[model samples]
Target: MATAYWKGANTKTGGGFWSSGHTPTLIAAFLYFDLAFMVWVLLGPLAPAISKALALTPAEKGFMVATPTLAGALLRVVNGLLVDRIGPKRSGAISQLIVIGGLLSAYLLGVDSFGGTIALGVILGFAGASFAIALPLASRWYPPDHQGKAMGVAGMGNSGTVLASLFAPGLAKLFGWNTVLGLACIPLAIVFVIYMAMAKDAPGRPAPKSLSEYLHPLKSADAWWLMGFYSVTFGGFVGLAASLPIYFTDRFGLTPITAGYCTAACVFAGSLVRPIGGALADSIGGIKMLIGVFIVAALALAAVSIAPTVGSALAFFVVAMLALGVGNGSVFQLVPQRFGAEIGVMTGLVGMAGGIGGFYLASSLGLAKQWTGSFAPGFLIFAALALVALVSVFVVKSQWRRSWGAAEGVRI
Candidate 1:
């Protein structure tokens, strides 16, 4: 009965593109996420320009990009609570309003100092929290059989970074960087109206969870495993998205526009392939897919850390981002499989872990460059972490396949 309510049609897992779930909400979720993601990673491509204006150090630049990630991490959990309590519609609207106000303030006041930029990053963190709100908003509307496709379509909004890397610098070039914030508000406002009109709460949402109920999952080992794996996949994906502009500029002496172009190309590899990853995971097992993802990402990150010549670096990042993007989808495939009833809470927890991973990588890259005169150390460390996650996955695979995962109808 619950499944029938979630699946409005004869939609099956391999059905046509629009074969499953609430199409209107999925579209709204993606739009909301796409715009939210742009603002979330805004400071990354703009970091070089802002650093020039503020005279910030490498470490300062890193924090400038990382602050939003960390703030967003914390906010994801809060947004999760709000989703269960006030519902995704209200929570998303409020979060969007706060982010809109922040952008408006940045545009009108003009960020003059490093501190001001940091404050803006904090505001941008709310945009990052869109992950928690938007995923559940889309996921609850779909049946388990088609969860991957629905979530992937919504999750592809992570590609919002591509839009940021491609256009923000150009817009900044035409109008002052600060004014870019005001301009950002235009698109955000438009999405806000559209999302409000189109999106709705699903019929089969779980009861609003109490704090203890939400926290209870933390007691389980599987929860931690999902968190660790996501930290690497999503963390690495977004951290790179935010920090690549700085790396390109500092390493190759590219203009902000050029850096943005390269970043956009690499991120496009990630964004476009996410749905493919989800579909693939649906076809194969998520764990089997993730092992390969971590291996590719580890190798690619290692190559990029060398800060090779322009061509080699771009190629390496292109592969690295693609692997990480697939990993992001693969991890979510398991999330609903492992924690179906607690999907909202688990999304927040796992998503926050991913944000924290991004925060660490982004900041560490800045610090690594500052301390060693190269980004190699940070890349090496994360590569090792990826390897660790690989080993951890190997350890958990049997346990998961033998337990609750066995009951999950979709591939696990």
Candidate 2:
């Protein structure tokens, strides 16, 4: 197979599918992942509405929202390895089909019973696995020099949470939650078809490694460090995305619609700005970007911990979430710099860690709210973790700079 590369003016070089530049493929991949993410996070924004109808307790509500995240986190490693073996395009399409099935099943299950909702939540997690496929797909399309931007663009699909938060509640109100869930299938179906028809695997890629080679990164200290960084960054972003609606409604006396919109706004800022964060890291340095984001995130989370009013709390939450989003992009930028060759396996592992982080944060918030009747403890705990992450990054900065051989990393 011939590799695709840019040609001189007026020249068409290669016959490979990506010879025209990767923008279209990137966009298609983004849409596919975005729809998956939207479905994966549907329960969070829909939780308040479903709970009102079901009279669910706080702990049950948290479990309902967090189950998909937990499932997704666990499934990412499986999807990542599948992508490496079958190629990203095929893996992504298959994931989307699975997501469509999950959504349809969730719709059929309805919101009548807690057990039904939990079952659906677990199934929807397959949407979360789309992360493994989309990120690697975009990364493979561009050369290593352009990976920050490519991955950033693909990652912007995480903004899909914004769409779910913004619309799912209102749609549920108008047509019922089950109908809203069923409607989600429309977008997924369309994206799945388009991706299948137009997308192609990256050309001239090497054959996948043996299972042992793929798993070897697990034994490396750097892999664990990257996992920690991702757990804080991407994990925080996802956790907040899954919990914000419940937090707003329970703590502030807001209506489900209002809470959903607020949650959507928070997700929007984080998701849309993620690419910019990657670009910034590319131009400056990933270490500097990570340090700055972590500091701001800690301060913001601390402010939320002490906020006297709902408005102040919301403001702090928004800021903290945005910083976490940027940190998500920056951490991945650094990951490739330090471990480019091991990206597939490392992505699976680190992505899993991030997913677990999200699950813990969301569940912990629920537990705190249930036991103490306040989210302050949860906020403070995450703030402390952010501070530790900040110090850890600074401590490792010199080593990363020497090993990566770039003054600064690539800006997305």
Candidate 3:
């Protein structure tokens, strides 16, 4: 199919188009991913207002924020498979349309009831699954040597949370939360149309994997290890991004606007730094970057646990987000090196792990607040988990190095 497309393009344009990079394709994919991410994280900015209005318990509040993440995780595998069957361009446009519908439905339902909020959250998660399609779409368009930068650029769409964190609360405050949600649909609708018009699958690539080949990676230990690493890195980044506004409001008595600003800073720092992280990984190696990121993240989380004032809390949050962002880049760096051919399936599994981790982190914070009347325990727990991940990374590093070298030498 890709060969056919390439031939068609060559015949039409006399080969000039083939020499140009796929910049338009990359841009369209990035926009699609960004919109999905914004919707995926809607609950974070709205949590304080929604919880207070509904009189929700802390655990309930946590679950409300986590529902979309859980749903998104489960949908990633389905989306990954669908991308091959339908192509990223079609899948992205359709997914965005679905997200627009979901946002509209949530706006109409009005987040007044616990069940209603959870249902809305599930719809938002469907939007988040767009990641499975967007990342691979961008990667396939680039040459192998450029995959890291391409993926990094495309993955920056995750920064969409920064916009949500920065503005959603203010919007909700100005127009009422429901109206703000209804407004989100406008962008989704526009982006959906633009993506459909511009995005296309890469030309001259192999057909997508067979069902059996796609399933084969599931039995590999390396795949699961990568998932575990991502669960700690990308997972931590997303979980914290989605939960920060609520955490600030609950712990510091901050207003919704103030909380949104703080969360925005954290998310923006992480998202903007992702490309840098990828570049650093290319230079210094993924294992070293992962080691440093884990250490920094653990210390930052511990610092947050003991932070006594809003300034101190914000400082720790920024540091933690930076570390997690770097770790996210390192994890993906190692992923393609280890699972090049199985990229789609492995992305689904690893992406799901990250989503599940976000769900766990959000729920745990809520549980700690409700059960113990403090968030310190939750912070400590996350720090401890980072420590475990650090150890796991070290244990796997030597094995991966040897295996990768042997495989490359054999290919040569």
The sequence of per-residue lDDT tens digits that candidate 2 reaches over residues 1-412 is 1122211211332233244346667888788878889999999988988888888888888888889888999899988788778877888877777778877876776558988888888888889878888887766666545556677888999989988999999998899888998999998898888887766666655468888877877787777888898888888899999999999998888988999988988889899878888878767867888989999999998898788887888788789888988898887777666556666666777888899888888888988889999988988898899999998987777776665435423332
Q: State model 2's lDDT.
A: 0.80
Q: Residue-wise lDDT of candidate 1 within 116-138, one digit each (tens)? A: 98899999999999999999899
TM-score of 1: 0.96
Checking candidate 2 for backbone clashes, the offending pairs are 278-412, 279-411, 279-412, 282-410, 282-411, 283-411
Q: Give the candidate number with the greatest TM-score.
A: 1
Of the candidates shown, which would achieve the greatest lDDT relative to the real structure? 1
The 0-to-1 C-alpha lDDT of every candidate, in the order given, reads 0.89, 0.80, 0.80
List the candidates ranked by lDDT, beginning with the highest. 1, 2, 3
Mark the 10 consecutive residues where model 1 has the least summed lDDT.
1-10
TM-score per prediction, in order, is 0.96, 0.92, 0.92
Clashes of each: 0, 6, 0
